[model samples]
Target: METPTAPGPDVPRRSLISGSAAMAAAGGLVLGAGAATAAAAAMAPNGASGVVQGARNGDERHPFYGEHQAGISTPPQDHLVFTAFDVTATTPVELQLVLAKWSAAMAELTNGRPVGKVQPARANGVPGDTGEAADMGPHGLTLTLGFGPSLFDGRFGLEKFKPAGFDQLPAMAGESLDPAMTGGDLCIQACANDPQVAYHAVRNLARMARTSVRTRWTVLGFGRASAGANQITPRNLLGFKDGTRNIKTEEDFAEHVWVGDEAGQGWMAGGSYLVARKIHMMIETWDEDPINDQQGIFGRTKQAGAPLSGTREHDVPDFHAAAPGGGPVIPADSHIALAAHENNGGTKILRRGYNFTDGLDAVGRLDAGLMFLSFQRDPEQFVALQRKLGSSDRLNEYIRHVGSGVYAVPGGLPAAGNYYGKEFFPG
Candidate 1:
């Protein structure tokens, strides 16, 4: 299928309001109390919208437009409702329209407003907004979009526009993938502090794209954030502090996360590659293990999240250090030992994974684990780490990698235009 090429100027390039401005405008409209109100005010400038702005609060309300996408590095939200879609549009124009609509809806949703203004009298037709999140604040919602390698097929004449590193991932060892959960033509990762907010974002976008896309697979996840004033680490379902040593800071992000301009596919510059995996944890088996055994597998103290070689969580692991009796303090086969940057040619990826629970399986065993999401400058970084982890990580015995995908996330929407992936469709 093909679309008649329209004149360049005819395509919609911008939404009604830019993402940042929308947030600023909505900031004054007080949502609720506590973090929600503080977050909203922080997003807007003082007196910008006649609302009394507070000192910057928690990591909420990331701008939708920038050099790089927000969700990848923006503090990981507490909940996630990630969905992958198969583009069913027969024409490029139809696909572009879907993106335009998605961008407009996303702008409003991220600003703590309903997709459409409420008008009871004119609401005779299909509801313009789903209304699930009508009263809830934005909750630091971030909607990140990406294109899978399948999107570059001949369907939209995008074969030649495929980014260099945007290839389907090669199969790794120990993968028992379910076909339904494996791949998709495109993906959107909706993350928010509140689960309902996240779900609402994805649901509305999928609804809007009903004509141009079909849902391939979706995963809902929640995370347990650390308690206390300085909440730095979040625990996974495995009861281990995940992403403790993850790449943070602007310098690290530039070095390890954002794709460089010279890295082939100009459209992908400032963007990053996402590697998603659905790992099923063998809960019954893991639960039977002793505390020491569990700690040994992860190479970290369960209570303090400290490396086996050190007493503090932030202390750099001395991989070469020996225990009192002998042997390495951090076990050779432990998850951290093999997956660490030191072991992988100094490579690192930004982890934004979330713990998930999906009730029980047919056998009545608890079906819960992680939706592993990692972003890197290159897909090779994740591929290399996974290859090592699959072979020797001790935690492998208790986890099974059942679903996977790789996507090339393009740079953020330009300040003037709210459209996404517009560069891929340039005439």
Candidate 2:
């Protein structure tokens, strides 16, 4: 369907919510966001901890130019298609010409190439690469791009660069949230290791911004529930083991995941702050509970995910060990003792979650869950660890958080004609 061009002379005309007036301009660029598997690349030439440098190769790629951004420390990819957009442009320079045509089509769909010319039996020709992931080589895809919070509600003057504690995501506690599956002004996550090459890269960037973006809510995840770099921890849908104390190395992602300069927004210093959520999982009431009450409601070890005060899966959790006709052998309302960043005062994030299903419901059950994702420089470190796991996490009695969002994600793309929020539209 490709037909939305025109925006060349250094990009910036503003007027169409049908208020008419036209005269766009343009430039180019790309990069950033979360991860999952395919190990052997702990990046760090100032790009921070990474992944996807080998294993499961279909030409494992990850490098849309960097210094931060390649799916938030690239490595996690075993499907995920996350979406969220809804910008329908009316200014901010037509949303910066849809981030300069989505940074020249996400630098050719994360280097597997092809943002155009898929002739599709042309009659008058309009294919522009929608041929369902043509050859699909780059299985380690990664596309990122974010910026919600009503895209800074002053409509497009961008409420003074909105990143200092970037809002929206408050009413916590076992959430039921569903305003048509929560908010969005723009987002795109797309990872790969193939689920149709991550749903053909967000379905060709929503069919090349079909007149300035619309699909606000997509999802689609699968497996790789969280684990990166030299991999291994992956199991959610309540089988435990998810991200086992995530935020790995690079000094724990520079003291808890990217975004520095105190996030007062110096172009969001090497950006980071996604937060998605979906969750649901009631899977027949957590498969009829009782496996020692589901390992004391996830204090761990539902088959070696370790930690009832530690035995293996990366050990370390001894939150005051005790339990012999006593009180604390892990269960401080366990979900790893309330998401243990050592009981939250140390606060960490960066999970990169997945695992989902969409099938039955009208009382048939099994709709399945956990999209969750993470990454944080300060989303109050996931709102103080989900307000202490939505008021006491005993794995919240079989999950329910139904869809939410929070983006921002703005670093990396320092070369090739620069685009994508190029510092929030400077001349």
Candidate 3:
């Protein structure tokens, strides 16, 4: 195992949670909570959206092939805690095709009726789709299914999660007309159906998405490896970068995602758990701003990653240091201000976001942003943070929420027989 090395003065932690720290961390506890919000990048001069989507993996594609932080090792072979596909579309039939091969299919969002108090898939008591129902294949399939720990978690025996799987596939970048555009029916934005992937298993679905004729919404999903030959380290679209500002895995479920607690019921557990929002960035707008203005909004420098009115990116803002009597130096409305409680541990969520950039725009537009997707324990925790940002924050001015929806991320699968969200939310 390699030793952890905290990156130099500018980089984040590069070491291990040795001794008590490691023990506490292993058991699911975080000490100090530092935050790193987006800082404005220097305007691209010519006014181009600097954002760019990562291309298909050109190197080896497998769970075991990639390298991760030292000491934090995977099995002799690589695996995932789970794999999921959030495909989008209209026409119940179109969505049906994707689920045709699966053991069960659940229409999660049909014209706006949230899967009411989700129960076991069997409770719907609709006859199985195997024999008499097998004909449903004619209609396409819609899915929010996934591969869980049983299918991805490396440590299944003692952990609260288990089951993992492996497969690779194709995908692309594109969309279709949704009622959301004309307000006819709901438009689908499947991250599972986007144009980013390393290998080929899920590509089959992407190909299907592009070809499907009946759907109103287009697909914008990406297939990640649940198991097998595909690699993804904890980094943003930037190759050498790792989103260290994020919470740990254990903290992921317990904090952000829904788990049986005094607040909610058990069915919500292994069921959420919850889906975060789809925050889109107006890359063009962001790319056109001056660095000084950018720094003002984020309170940080792009290169040094330091706060405008402060020291380093992780340095606690000396909110009171400057004026014995303070007045908006850090801008109470800034993104940093709203996300401030994250430092106090008041409310935290596991942010597993992705960076995507579509090509260029006609009038030099930039269609790219970080897919601000996160899993949460409750929608309110996230909303509260947003409430702080209010409806009109500096960040919001440059970002547009083109798509929005939620899903109950499923549990782990034991084998290939049939796995997805169906098993997690038992009827």
Candidate 4:
């Protein structure tokens, strides 16, 4: 995959990093190439990370940051433990069979081993990634299987592929490998503790993945999955402002976000990621209000990340920090105040997520909302803090939680090579 190299034209700076990486993890967008520049600075600030660093550019006239990522919305509503599979004779098949055996042997719990109740699914037959029938390739088959919640943690007893540290655990079971020599193709995620539910969901996926591998249909590797509940990403709901507060600090940011140094290793550094989220937006209510009201809800102009009372879209808000005792300029309890944390001295995050509209309903209605997603090293400080800040803010009502999940986005495994502990876990 060719890495996107085109830098979007620079735009003026805004008060906060819009949909940043942390926002993405929270279900939000990806960062564009080079969004920061001098020309875009109509009125610069003392410390500007990047223009539209966290933005929602879907609105044409940029209610804020006029030219910054104007009118571009992030792709929304798709998330799975994305990986590319290379089909071959040696690949493992009968994962369901394995599940049946494991289930019979172990408890009904789901974990690394398969659950007992799984069925075979065909890659060439499945509707989602079935692809063009006429375009079969010769090198090796490519199969992409997106495991649902059931397989990993949807179920109660089964929590295979969930996130946790296993001391000295071999990477693989039959032919095990160590982390030093292996980047797992099997991505593990932590769902919201309903292991039983995750079991059923992923069990179905195992059958399909196993069958495809058996049939020499595909070799698996990570692909840029649309961020959702099961994948990790770098963007959010509104398009422009994503991944702004992501720590560029040498140790953590590089270790977590950057491709190789620590997170993935040298071989597969900078490789693509699997992003996922369940962004619950109250469209029924959010869109019902007039445009200005909508703007008020988000604290910035609806289409841009600007203060409700400010001009020049990206101009910094006068948070009434030094306002006269008479009035509230930006509204102390507004979404912007909660979002910007300006009163508390602006805190930010890295956001990468998507915008999706559940199919229109009877009244020509849509579940249009943001599948906000993001990733970062410390979820506590950045992500958790923001949630706490916005807890009682005005925007909470419309956006409520319907689903939530987390995944351990692993680094890549080298192709055609033995993994670490190959000696320990003999294949």
Candidate 5:
């Protein structure tokens, strides 16, 4: 994949990296790259200094710094380790320090290097970097940070920095939200081809910030449930192709996914809002249903994944096509009919969800589900469609909404010495 360039000239590079990492540079926690005149080398980690080069398998890597954060619009990876964190610091500076440390560590990790100075094996001294992913190439790993709604609840003096439309999602129908898994002050989304690579990124990050933050909840997912640019659609636990109409083209991203200056907060201009839902599927029950009923639930053929009115997967659904007898060909309550952008005022969301399975739930039936994740310019795009799904979608009978979160993902760092969310804490 080509390295994504910096955002259009409207967003200044300095403004993107002016805060936490710069603060660390002043205090000596970080090293300086070349002077301003040095040409940009291969992209560094989001907040770390200097170009990171190394040997690897296929050198499958994604640049950490770009116009928008990696892992959002980037093609979906094979595995995911999504984690939310709660800040325990009492002051803004304390929280800033935590973000700074994480930023520097991310730079190294994404560049296929270890965090901090790598030291030789010592008999008594502990190592500064965790050695789990030592030899692993970048593995196409991407770590994207997000600030949850709680982070702006008058904490860290960030209330004024919250986007105008940003807020916790309201309780929609069919939701039995678990308090422990619902809200968080921050979140980090790690996606990579290797499960270990994704896990190592989160494990090391949590270890580094243990003093200032605690993991609120985590989910490990495999077999991406959605497709991105040039990717083929993958199936969800429900045995149906998911995200068949996801936002893909640059035009679609600008229209539906990436946030623009209308965000009412300049810092969030290139950033997007994220919504995650833990949807537990009743696999046993779903498997018992007749194939025709299953097809009706999703409005797509089980084997071919084509719309009810079409013969192929990508064929536009003829929502208005008449059935042989009298009714509409596609049921109004089917998942696709209700969630389709055409039916919802042309609204679209970029989906990067994954299929997940835990051992089992309370009763002994398999505990597996879709970790429903989507990014949009505004959260309401999801809310409006979900409200429709939550209330009337036929598929609701086979799933339960147990956990949820909404976060404001800031724009990407422009270069080294820039931490995520730097624009939020301007001097």
Candidate 6:
């Protein structure tokens, strides 16, 4: 396979350095040629300092600094380990320090380098970095951080800065939310092509924040990519193509996913709101159902993933099309129909969801499902679409919303700051 290069302009020779030189500067750790190639490709377009490099393994790397966070718009990775934490800090200063450490560490890890200065094994007095991922490349890791509504409840004098739409999501119909799995004061979304790399990113961050925050919930997820030859769309646990009509281009992202300056609070100008739902699939029950019924639940053909009214997977569904008996071919209550943008007043969310199987439940059935990650300009967009699904989606019979969280993900780090959420900290 061809090696992936950073997407954009080339860097000047004056600012460029050899692979060995870069690694030596980054704590004397030796990196493979692939990692070196990624580092070289990530140089700033104008040859400015502080360019965030891509990961090793020839996987793409997203820049850590920009107007918006990387993972939100960066193409979705193959594996995800989403985590939420409850902040234990009493003052703004303490919270600021945590963000500083996390921001610095994130930049390094995403570049396929260890956190802080790497010490020799013999000098190990509380080593700065965990060595689990020492050999593993970055594997296209992207770490996204967000603040939950509860984080602004006057804890650090941030209640006044909370965005108007940032609040605890209202209880939607048909939800069996578990307290243990729901809500958090902060959230970190780690996505990578390798599961071990993804886990390592979150593990090290959690360790760094051990004193100021505690893990509230975590969900490990993997995606089933299309196989060779005929396979086309990625399948969910329910054995249907997922995210067929997802937002993809920059035009759609600007319209649907990214928050604008005029949208609300100044701090959230280019940021986006994230909605995470741990949807539990009743695998055994669904598997026992007939093929026709299974297809009916999602309103798409099982094998081809085309709408009932259309033959091709990418063909738009004629919602008004009729069947032999004059009924709507794509049923009104079908999963696709209810969640369609046209049905929801032109609203759409960028979905970067993943499939997960966590062994079995209390009854010995597969505890498999989708860790649904949706990024939108406003939280109300998710609310509107979800309310429709909860009340009428046919797929609801086979799934339950057990875990949910909404977070305000801020824009990317500024050119000078070395901390996440530094704008929120008082001078």
Winning candidate number (lDDT)? 5
1-427 per-residue lDDT for model 3 (tens digits) = 1111121221111121012123232433221211000000110111111121123222111111011110011111111111233333332323222332221112111001111111224565421111221111111112233222222222212122321211111111221212242211112222222122211212323332332322322323232211111223332222212232344455444555544433333223443423323335566556678877776676545655554566654566544435346675676555665575544366765454455555555666655544444555554565555555545467667665554333334332222223232222112
Clashes of each: 0, 14, 59, 96, 1, 0
Query: Which pairs of residues clash in candidate 6, taking residues 3 or more apart in a chain or in different chains?
Result: none
How much is 134 displaced in model 2, in angstroms? 43
Candidate 3 vs. true structure, TM-score: 0.48
lDDT comparing candidate 1 with the true structure? 0.74
lDDT of 2 by residue, 267-316 (tens): 77888889999989887888888788898887878878888887898888
The C-alpha TM-scores of every prediction are 0.85, 0.33, 0.48, 0.42, 0.87, 0.85
Q: Write the per-residue lDDT of candidate 1 for residues 277-316, one digit (tens) a residue.
A: 9999998899899999999999999989999999999899
Model 2 worst lDDT run, 10 consecutive residues: 33-42
What does the lDDT come to for candidate 4? Answer: 0.31
Note the Cα lDDT for every prediction shown: 0.74, 0.73, 0.32, 0.31, 0.77, 0.75
Q: Could you tell me the lDDT of residue 409 within candidate 3?
A: 43
Q: Give all candidate RMSDs, comma-separated.
A: 10.2, 19.1, 20.3, 19.5, 6.4, 8.2
* Model 2 alpha-carbon drift over 4 Å, by segment: 1-16, 20-95, 99-209, 212-258, 262-265, 275-282, 285-287, 291-295, 299-318, 325-328, 331-334, 343-347, 350-363, 368-375, 378-426
Residue 108 C-alpha lDDT in model 6: 60
**For model 3, what is the alpha-carbon lDDT of residue 363?**
61
lDDT of 1 at 163: 76
Top model number, TM-score: 5
Q: Write the per-residue lDDT of candidate 4 for residues 256-312, one digit (tens) a residue.
A: 443343432232233223323344455666646776665555556644545656754
Candidates, ranked, lDDT? 5, 6, 1, 2, 3, 4
Of the two candidates 1 and 2, the one with more favorable lDDT, higher being better, is 1
Q: If candidate 3 were superposed on the true structure by all CA atoms, what would the RMSD be?
A: 20.3
